[model samples]
Target: MQLLFAAPARKPLQVDRHLRRQIVRYLTTCFEILSPAAEELIPDELEQWGQLRIGNGGDEIHARGYHKLRPDGRDAAFVRYELMVDQEADNPSVDERLEPESQYGELQHIFVLTIPPKTPKVNPHRKKKRHLLLAQIYEAPFKFDEADKYKVIWYKGKLGTGEVVDALTIQCVIDAGEYLYPYIPMFDSIL
Candidate 1:
């Protein structure tokens, strides 16, 4: 005789409003400051705030803004803002670095804000998502060799068949700027 068992239903993840608002505010402010010249060209109909489904099969709060326009009156480049909230307490440390894999394809700009786990919990058997949040904002062309900047990691490899592999990893760890401080009060309250 064969026995049948029913699988348990999964519950939807809860949305944290405070964290979401912080992420939106940060992204909006950055867009306004970074690309002031192209701001007027962006279409007003685009989504200012909404939920974006990331590659990891999870929905994150996102704010989208256009920054550039093409000669034909079309949007050329836009910025995407993402917020990743870590609920698992036993997760690893929060890395301020941004990886290429974390970004969507060919976006002109991508900003991710990660909220660390509120409390430490034990969960050794489960796997966690790999995501990094913004820790600092730096002006372009800034020298990495500066005293405050962190060192970048370079990885090179070759396949047995003589194929070469090239990769570069950069980690950012600077103090969050004044614009980001407003969100801190909300983050502290939630924790």
Candidate 2:
């Protein structure tokens, strides 16, 4: 017979996010509806994200092209939590001329913030679930490369002391990269 008792898996460390006003405002701009329901779901004073969620924790969800970050997924040599800015999804040409290479910060402690579905008693018209993948961005304030402007693949960075964790946008993410791995010559290894 199978054992009646079993030990739980070790819990992953979580980082609490204290979202700022700017990030919260950005969310509204991203999906503007200006309806009463929208206002309630995303009020200007909604500073807390699902009641101050601690980092990724053990509750992992799927992020496209980065299954390693998921709690339940396969085909990864190793689960990578590192996320980089998506060059293809964003305006690379504009950034190439205007922004610095180091401005496309690094993402850490990535997690999926899924909005719970309504219980369906009154709101049976609900559709698919919504998931927002968020992370803390770290920028290399001192590093710069002329040739790699707006297309930096690798660089050293430090997360600010009072940085907001949930300030990421879906359009800015691309793929995964090993954090703290030895610096390599290949520029594409950033993620």
Candidate 3:
């Protein structure tokens, strides 16, 4: 006897509430460390910063990048949260030049929250899930060898846990850098 059966229907992707809350906490801590005063002054901007959304499959987190000054009050950085597939080239390229190399006195930081790709549910009884890989925080500095005017200087896997502690530590480091060497004009500042 032959048996006939229909394939199981695919379920819609649901937002991970736990991960969402973690992201919110992470961003909150970052902003508080980076610019506590600005939060109250620019509530709208901070609200926008906390907004997170799901992106189309294939490694892209649909979220707006937030810009704020470092604790030193001179330097600035752009913080972004993204859900990305494990595949290479999915993350935004830092190769493009945001501004001229000669116009900057300091490098601008690009802090990113990277969510690794979801594992495929190979078994019928199993379910796919996503998790935070690491927070990639890098500096966009000037370089002459490449086509683009800027080069990326990674912070050696800083904020790898995507937790408040890491965020605060990174903030302090950034502030210290600024204090020791004041008046470092970033590319964003020039633009």
Worst-scoring 10-residue span by lDDT in model 3: 42-51
TM-score of 1: 0.16
Error of 3 at 21 (Å): 27
Mind giving the per-residue lDDT tens digits that candidate 2 earns over 1-191?
A: 11111222133323233433323443454455333433344322221121111233321223222223434322111112223445554665554233212233434334334444561321233675555444434443333355854544444444343222343331233233455664311132223
Each candidate's lDDT (Cα)? 0.24, 0.33, 0.27
- What C-alpha RMSD separates each model from the true structure? 21.9, 12.2, 19.2
Best to worst by lDDT, what's the order?
Answer: 2, 3, 1
Give lDDT tens digits, candidate 3, residues 59-125.
1111112334434454323332222223433456544333212211111211223322331221122
> Residue 190 error for model 3, in Å?
29
Superposed Cα deviation of residue 70, candidate 2 (Å): 18
Q: Which residue runs of candidate 3 sit more than 4 Å off their true CA positions?
A: 1-64, 70-125, 133-136, 140-172, 176-191
Clashes in model 2: which pairs?
15-55
Error of 2 at 93 (Å): 22
